[model samples]
Target chain A: MTTAAGSRTLAHPGLGEITLEGVLHAFADPMRMRVVRDLAREEGAELSCSYFALPVSKSTSTHHFRVLRENGVIRQIYRGTAKLSVLRRDDLDALFPGLLDTVLAAAARQAERRTAAGS
Target chain B: MTTAAGSRTLAHPGLGEITLEGVLHAFADPMRMRVVRDLAREEGAELSCSYFALPVSKSTSTHHFRVLRENGVIRQIYRGTAKLSVLRRDDLDALFPGLLDTVLAAAARQAERRTAAGS
Candidate 1:
């Protein structure tokens, strides 16, 4: 069913349908993990695809978003002419309880370590 | 590089060298995740490779174990004729705090939910 926001509808796995293996696999890729890290930092703010300045090509970015959406890590809905994405924090929190936060924190820690070492 | 336990040695990423992406990727596979879940439940108890009755062939099981070890999720060492595997709990806990526990708990919860639904 297409929402009023746009003509296209995205498929998202229900909270009950989300699996631990799916989530882990979705976040395994560096690009996908970066998308998740950004979403977590935004704290539930729904941002359009254009908001993420990923280094990859547009098609590659789309693939990454699709992976996240298919794995139930993020929910995507079209708003106006743009497709916005948001972390399924509520569903994930209910299902896994602190898993998202722990992973985000770990990613941040690792990034900080990399930055420090690089400097 | 050989120890008295056996004549062979395995390469494992050092604690500091382990990356968040690598850890997630290692746990992404169902077989690998099962191996990890079993290891976590044992709570630091080192078990030989033969202890795990994985449904896959010996080669596939070895590959999964290698992935886990190379990702720094588990430490493997030879003991006599058997190669024992143990979760690198201390290293993982130190690197990512409660990540391992949260994942393990999530897996357990999901398994319980599936069982309940199946019944």
Candidate 2:
């Protein structure tokens, strides 16, 4: 999203402002978790909001992104007309060392377990 | 709580029934997180429900404990007249290894940060 004043900016919690509970709450939702997982997979690369194939209405997707941004789990920036999201891995690791990697690994393991169970 | 049935048992999700989102949701609350932290500190030892002085009312604390049990974050058992709570560390570690430890570590860091800020 952009404005006449150039690129529009989204508000995000500073590293010190991020709470463990807030981050956990943001990741507790499946849709939001999907977003985080995708972003984490890409390392620190910024992906546009439209890049996610969320199984939710546009409004709900926006809400999830907003929740992630507010919780400081992801950093959102406007690039032209696209709003890009990048996982705050560095900030998270700084605040809670190895938390992001542990969570992402756990998420991946859960995915594999569910797939295997289904099969 | 015990009954004519010898020892009353509380319903908790089986290892297969536990979900990452559910665990994260259970830990997302401040009061519930505090309970989990104390239980984690005790390792596998059982602690009565009244062992910790939660700021919330007895009813509210009970609700928090129920949430934790249902989410597979803790196991509750009837020990005499007291309801003992234990962290389901083994089950959780089997399902999502190191997740519980990482979360507890993060929570402790957050507490220290908060205390330092307050002082």
Candidate 3:
């Protein structure tokens, strides 16, 4: 909620303003979905931007995080030099019950299937 | 599966090839989501494209339908002059478990919330 010096404040859409289309668009990208999956796995844990080991450029990962934050999928807060992100699970569940969990489950299933096929 | 004369065959990604990203992108558009929701509600009923009372132009509707079909969300078959579409519920359920149902439920909840808020 509060920002420290040199850390920019990020604008996030309120729960009321978060539309289904916006959330779907945010998760449509592979990178963004990966970030969401990781956040979901971490649950209550707040992760900094550098925590995610995404196979993309730093700017690209930043873009994906911004997309997720702007769409109200995650809440990003500045913590000194680190910008921490936490999944907006409560807001999303309240608005669209079972959606976030279902997406996470699907992602997990897909990942397992991919790993199995690869092995 | 079969196409009639003058009707072009639409290319659809097979169940094995359908990625979560593609399905999410297909449903990210409001019009396409509406189409999928309707298809889900009807279940086994196959309806023609003209059956959907969308607010968009004919071309735009066609494009949305194409996106859904190409992403493996729905199966569009040429039934004479009408291109009938049916939700690929089985394929999706097998691949992603409860994803389609969850999305439909979320859409319904959001619509109800919007209506209640408006009233």
Which candidate tops DockQ? 1
Model 1: DockQ vs. true structure:
0.88
lDDT of 2 by residue, A1-119 (tens): 34465456777888888999999999899899999999988888999988998989999999999999999999888867888899988899999998888888889999998999999
Model 1 over residues A21-67: C-alpha lDDT tens digits?
99999988889888898888888899998788999999999999998
Q: Write the per-residue lDDT of candidate 3 for residues B4-76, one digit (tens) a residue.
A: 4745777878878888888889988888888998888888889999999999899989988888888999998
Better of 1 and 3 by lDDT: 1
| DockQ, structure candidate 3 | 0.75
Please provide the root mean square deviation of candidate 2 (C-alpha atoms, Å). Answer: 2.4
Candidate 1 vs candidate 3: which has greater TM-score?
1
Interface RMSD of each: 0.7, 0.6, 0.9
TM-score of each: 0.94, 0.94, 0.90
Q: Stretches of candidate 1 above 4 Å error?
A: A1-6, B1-6
Q: Residue A69 of model 2: what lDDT?
A: 94
What lDDT tens digits, residue by residue, belong to model 2 across residues B21-114? 9999998999999988888887888999999999979999899999999999888888678888889899999999899889999999999999
Model 1 residue B89 lDDT? Answer: 93
lDDT of 1 by residue, B1-119 (tens): 55464667878888789999999999888888888988888888999887889999999999889989989999999877788999999999999999999998888899899999999
> Model 3 clash pairs?
none
TM-score of chain B of 3: 0.91
